[model samples]
Target: MRCIIMSNELTKKAAEMLLNGATLLSEPCPYCKGVRVMKDGNALCVNCGKNLK
Candidate 1:
């Protein structure tokens, strides 16, 4: 029996693509624009889950 393992470089490239494909808002939420926003990790909007950069 033989098994093939993926390389770390390949895994890293895939991860980068996924992250880049995601939407990254440069401005604030229209509803709560100008309000203070914080990063909680992952792709989530600070005001309404709109995805932050």
Candidate 2:
């Protein structure tokens, strides 16, 4: 199976955002167009519970 990996810089940025209570917004979820996405641990999604990335 192929393995997906994240670079150190990307991981660091995500951690920083989480620590500062900040969230990264890339694009809207196809299922939910709602904004104000929040970060749950390493996952990001809108208040509607849609996974953004």
Candidate 3:
């Protein structure tokens, strides 16, 4: 098996999305009030267990 490495630019973008809450678009989780939300189809919070949809 081979491993894939991410570039600095890509890593920065991902970090910005996860840290800056851009992916969540300023929407906080209702359950735990998490600021960051992953860009999944379900719009779930990463900090606590909550679904914002």
TM-score of each: 0.29, 0.32, 0.39
**lDDT (tens digit, per residue) of candidate 3 on 1-53:** 11123234344544666775546547776776755446555565555434556
Q: Give the best candidate by TM-score.
A: 3
Q: Across residues 1-53, which tens digit of lDDT does each residue of candidate 1 receive?
A: 11113234333443554566633345655664622233344444333334443
Across residues 1-53, which tens digit of lDDT does each residue of candidate 2 receive?
11123334345555665677877566665565534334664444433443443
Query: After aligning candidate 3 to the native by TM-score, how far in Å is the CA of 10 from where it should be?
Result: 19
TM-score of 1: 0.29
Choose 2 or 3, whichever is better by TM-score: 3
lDDT for 42 in candidate 2 is 41
- Between the candidate structures 1 and 3, which one is better when assessed by TM-score? 3
lDDT of 2: 0.49
Query: Which ranges of candidate 3 are over 4 A from the true structure?
Result: 1-22, 38-41
Q: Against the true structure, candidate 1 has what lDDT?
A: 0.41
Clashing pairs in 2: none
